[model samples]
Target: MEVSRIRYWLGVLLVFLAAFCFALKGVLIKLAYQYQIDALSLLTLRLLFALPFYIGIAVYQRKREPVAPLTLREWLWLFFLGITGYYLASYFNFIGLVYISASLERILLFTYPTFVLMMNAVSRKRGISRLQWGALALTYLGILIAFAPHIQFGNQHNVLLGAFWVILSGLVYAVYLVGSDSMIARVGSQRFTCYALIAATIPVFIHYLIRNGFALLNYPAPVYGLTTIMAVFVTVVPTFMIAEGIKRIGSANASLVASIGPVFTIVLASGLLGEKITALQLLGTAFVLAGVSLIGWKGKKM
Candidate 1:
């Protein structure tokens, strides 16, 4: 019992740290943008810096466990997931952040869980439960409320464009999550993540080469520094932390703990990026948290 208690608390701590680190992602991206680097270039640099770590993990895991080679079909699935989840989804998200405030970007991205539920319902050919319907309603309502201020005060067109891209990012990421379920069950999560990321790195580099061809590497030294931090701290570290946290506590509790991410992003944006925090945004955030929490609780019960 004592050991179990310690594990649970440690899981909570890992999840909290992961959430906090993820909250810094938007701010870091926003800061990197200040250096006038294009989204693709910054993304490429991040992946470049991150690639070695993931490769090392993959190699280490394979040697440690000595699993049989994956089938061709599994390789295809990994490629598909890597493209949709890491490459395209992240591309859209980085593009969206080019226009919107980090606070809004984080809030909008947080709605992906709703997309996951919707996709699950469709795929299963079952109607959403009343509780889930209410959860969905609350989630969209929160988005609208949070979005109103930007529409009123900011460049209406830019805000709309950014929100659209972010929403698309969320949708694609939801597809990735849904597809990953069976694959993760088959291949262990750590190996799956490492392999998927490795696959994703291929396309990222290809895209960078086609688009910029080394021309965009001429940025201030701080730009490289920021991307390195974003790669190691925000992207890679939190990922494994969340996975380990889930192993200890379970996905439901880890998700609940992760609800702190948007709130932390809001506070960080205010402090670092000078983004304002208004009552409506906070209210919207509360509603989103409640709705997502409802989903997590319902998912746990089911």
Candidate 2:
């Protein structure tokens, strides 16, 4: 029992660490954009660079257990998941960040749970309990507080557009989460991620050919270097860690721990990147944390 408890804490800590590492990707991409990397281009570099690692993990896992191979339909869905959720989602998010602050983007992105909840209610009538709803309310309140200072009053049209992209990212991301789990049950997690990422690369390459006329090789070393780091640290390492964490602790405990992502993002943005943090932002973060808590609380209740 003591060992299990220790392992659980260790897993939670690692997952939180993974969230922080993942949060840094936005700041890095923001830096890359300053050097003229377009949205698709950045995503291209990110996905392509990480492709091998994802596949490697899958192959390794496949060796350990004779896992079931993906069926044609599952492959098709995984392909779509990779393209829409991984490539398209990242593409829009990068572009949106160019128009909005990381602080605001994170706030909007964190609204995904609300979408997930709505989807659940629609798909099945098992709506959230009252306490869970209150927690969600607090969570969003915290998110709002965190972004209080970045809120501009006039000509907020671009903010509106950013919100749209962020919401789309959330929606598709929810689909990927829901759909991917279904796939996981079908063909195991490692193989599912590996094949899906490889499958998704097809659209990314096509996007590059159309957008940049196939001169993807002309960029400086830093572009490739940063892209590779984004793939490894941002994509491979953290993903593996998250999967491990979630495996050690089931989804219920894992969801609550994962909610630490936004809070990590805010602190990293403020302290490391020197983004401003206001009193309202702190309060809002508290609220958002509350919502995340509710979701996990609900998950555990069952």
Candidate 3:
């Protein structure tokens, strides 16, 4: 019992830390844009830096545990997951961040859980509980609180466009997560992530080559430096950490622990990007957090 408790708490810590690192995604992308790199170019650089590490993971997995080769169907599924979850989702997010505040982007992207819940209900052909429905209400209410002030004060069109992209990002990512349940079960989490990321890296490289071609070499030192930080710290490390966290704690608890992500992004955006923390944003943050808390608590009860 004591050992189990230790493992559970350790999993919680891992997931919380993962969420913290993941929270930096919006801020890092925002900072990277200051170098004048377009979304695809920066994304290419990020994937370029991350690819080697993912390859290393693949090699390590192969050596550590010799497994049967993936079937064609399995490979296809993984490829699809990689594209939807990482490549396209990331592309949309980077583009979206170019227009929106990092805080808002984070909040919008964090709605994946809600999407996942709805998807699960649809797939299972079951109705959501009153508690869940209420939680969803709270979450969206919080989103409105956070979103209204910025869109009201800023360029409404730009903010709305950005919000649309980020919402798509969250929806696609939620679909990826829903698909990942079986994939992660079929292959180990680490193996699945490594392979999926490898697959995702290809499209990123291809997209960059088509758009920028040799322009990648012309980037200044600061751009490279920032891309390196994003690739290793924000991309690779947190990606694996979250995967391991999910494996250890299960998705529900892991997501609950990750509810702190928006708060981190909001605080970081204020400090690092010089973004303001308005009253509405604060109130919205509270609502979102409360809604997420209610969902997690209600889930535990069920």
In TM-score terms, which candidate is top? 1
TM-score of 1: 0.98
Our tally of clashes for model 1 stands at: 0
Please write out the lDDT profile of model 2 over residues 189-280, one tens digit for every residue. Answer: 66777777888887888989998987778877788888888888888888778878888887777778777776677777776567776677
What are the lDDT scores of the predictions, listed in order?
0.91, 0.75, 0.86
Error of 3 at 264 (Å): 0.6
- Per-model TM values vs. the true structure: 0.98, 0.91, 0.95
Q: What 10-residue stretch in candidate 1 is worst by lDDT?
A: 151-160
Residue 38 CA displacement from its true place in model 1, Å: 0.6
Pairs of residues at least 3 apart in sequence or in different chains that clash in candidate 1 = none
Q: Candidate 3 lDDT, tens digit per residue, 73-154?
A: 9899999999998899889988899889999898888677789889988998978999899999999999999999876777
Q: Per-residue alpha-carbon lDDT of model 1 for 1-302, expressed as tens digits? A: 99999999999999999999999988999999998898899888888888899999989988898777889998999999998998999999999999999999999998899999989888988688999999989988988899899989874458899999999999999999999998888878888888888899899999998988877568999999999999999989998999999999999999899988999999999999999999999999988888988888888877
